[model samples]
Target: MRKKHEAPLDTLNSYLPVGAYHTVMQYLGHYKVHLTITKERRSVLGDYRFAVHGKNHRISVNGNLNAFAFLITLLHELAHLIAFEKYGNRIASHGKEWKLVYGEILQQFLLLDLFPPDIANEIKTTMRSPAAGSCAEDGLIRVLRKYDRKGDVKKLVEEIDVNGLFRTDDGRIFKRGDQLRKRIRCLEIKTGKIYLFSPVYEVTPVSHP
Candidate 1:
């Protein structure tokens, strides 16, 4: 969970999409936020922490994400900061107030034509009813995955046929099962235990004789 402090725009450009440098930096500057580029975390893409007694607002985004994903994740966290600033702790997280703020912020960015057509369309649809997580929109997540850096081939759990095997990042093998609502049932090879996994969980497919 190492966090790298803000770097020069030249250095930061490596992690952001083209034409997004100034806008992203401006938000960080205006809010006096302590922006951190962090190592990947399984549970969340990015997060925000409001300012306390003597500290500035803090925001962190996973550094390993693609440039587009990086920018989107940053904006998502920025929206959280803005919502908190306006409403304190009165509103529920991802409630109406937060959704409105998030949609507004995302719409502003959309006007800049920062994203590709497919991604933009999916994002627009997502804004109508923003979800708690940035990748909550299945269509958006599927489109975003196309921009991911190529290497270490992997596929979403939903892409694998039932009974097919896949290996997670931790090297555990699982046998894919039926789809149950949004999650897919999977059986662990070693433990023979069943687990429910998000359809979007990326895993390497396994070939068995």
Candidate 2:
């Protein structure tokens, strides 16, 4: 029997979502880093690892992300590695130093060819005081989710009817309530505490459609 050979892991774009393959390939080429596409989780989307303890630098992003989201998350983690190289974690994880590096990297993608006007504009503002999570930037996530698969971004307010129960993307269940500005004040079914949630927070309705 003849032995079979396999393609290089770097050549396999099956780990990435559609439209992200070429961009990610270029990113890996530029950084000389290891990329890992992990199973989707409810809380965290992606994370990064520094070249420490004799291990090569590695970056992991959740599987099935839309192109824009994947790019943003990838760049976000890449900034951490870049910042660590410069500052050596002397500053806070999201302090001024890291923010500077993250901002500089994010600016590289701010163009009509890379993203739409709405997304680019929002990214400009987000870089001013970059949030810890991409989901924290309402406008940015909104635009990114448009590029996601259907049913990936069900609006909390719309998906779960008023007074209905739903689970947040982060795994918290809440009983829907009245609106408060752009967010809704819902009661956490577990904690019994009222929490304000964005009307557009990605969620899955607990009850049937």
**Cα-based RMSD of the predictions, in order?**
2.0, 5.8
Tens digit per residue, CA lDDT, model 1, 6-56: 545568888988888888878888889888777757678888887999899
Give model 1's TM-score versus the native structure.
Answer: 0.91
For residues 49-137, could you state the per-residue lDDT of candidate 2 as single tens digits? 77778767887777667767777888888888788888886767878888899898777666325776777788898899998874468
Error of 2 at 99 (Å): 1.2
- Model 2 scores worst on lDDT over the 10 consecutive residues at 1-10
The lDDT per prediction is 0.86, 0.72
Global CA lDDT of candidate 2, please? 0.72
Give lDDT: candidate 1, residue 35.
81
Q: What residue runs in model 2 are displaced by over 4 Å at the alpha carbon?
A: 1-31, 157-161, 169-173, 180-183, 189-193, 198-200
